[model samples]
Target: MDKNEFLTVDEIIELTGFKKQSCQCEALTANGFSYAKDAEGRPKLTWTHVNAVLNGQINVVAYENERPNFGAI
Candidate 1:
């Protein structure tokens, strides 16, 4: 596996500061982040996804267990 290929669950957790995959998944979904699942059916955020979030290329409205407030949208 390439070192720059994909971001693991732990890496994503640390990067996004979420405790679990479900929480991270919800955040990613809210922010329109596209990721893939591992062989064990776990979500793996790719480098692109991380970069987009970190670099502000994408809208990350939530972190650390705070869900996006879609306020009647």
Candidate 2:
């Protein structure tokens, strides 16, 4: 969790299998994701934050899937 290492949006998308969207950004932020604007003003997430989310230390509701209802057999 080096503060110097930062992941780009594309990396996050690839790692999390999430489609690029504003909603995803919002979800990440809500889930304890720490981001800072790069020189281009693009949001850059710290590896610490990414790992936190991946390790379940940070929970994102939007990324959670609802349990399937199978009805009665």
Candidate 3:
């Protein structure tokens, strides 16, 4: 897999073993992988994110972005 390339739909299907987009998305989400739908509604994920999730490392920026900061409290 190229560093700059997003995982192709075939790759996603091979990984998740689902031919349907919805199932693929759910599988990816359930596994803590972050992805966006392409113009064709296929899940698109980066190799970096996949490796991070597989290696037990969360994407820090994404994790931080999902929480509310209460610094002023």
Candidate 3 lDDT over 1-73, as tens digits, reads: 7756788778999988899999999988777777989899999998888888888788655775786668857
Candidate 1 positional error at 30, Å:
1.4
Q: Which regions of candidate 3 fall more than 4 Å away from where they truly are?
A: 1-4, 59-73
* TM-scores for the candidates: 0.55, 0.44, 0.72
lDDT (0-100) at residue 2 of candidate 2?
67
| Model 1 Cα shift for residue 32 (angstroms) | 2.3
For model 3, the run of ten residues with the poorest summed lDDT:
59-68
Off by over 4 Å in 2: 1-4, 15-24, 58-73
The lDDT for every candidate, in the order shown, is: 0.69, 0.64, 0.83
Tell me the TM-score of model 2: 0.44
Candidate 1 or 3, higher TM-score?
A: 3
Q: Candidate 3 — which pairs collide?
A: none
Report the error of model 1 at residue 69, Å.
Answer: 19
> In lDDT terms, which candidate is top?
3
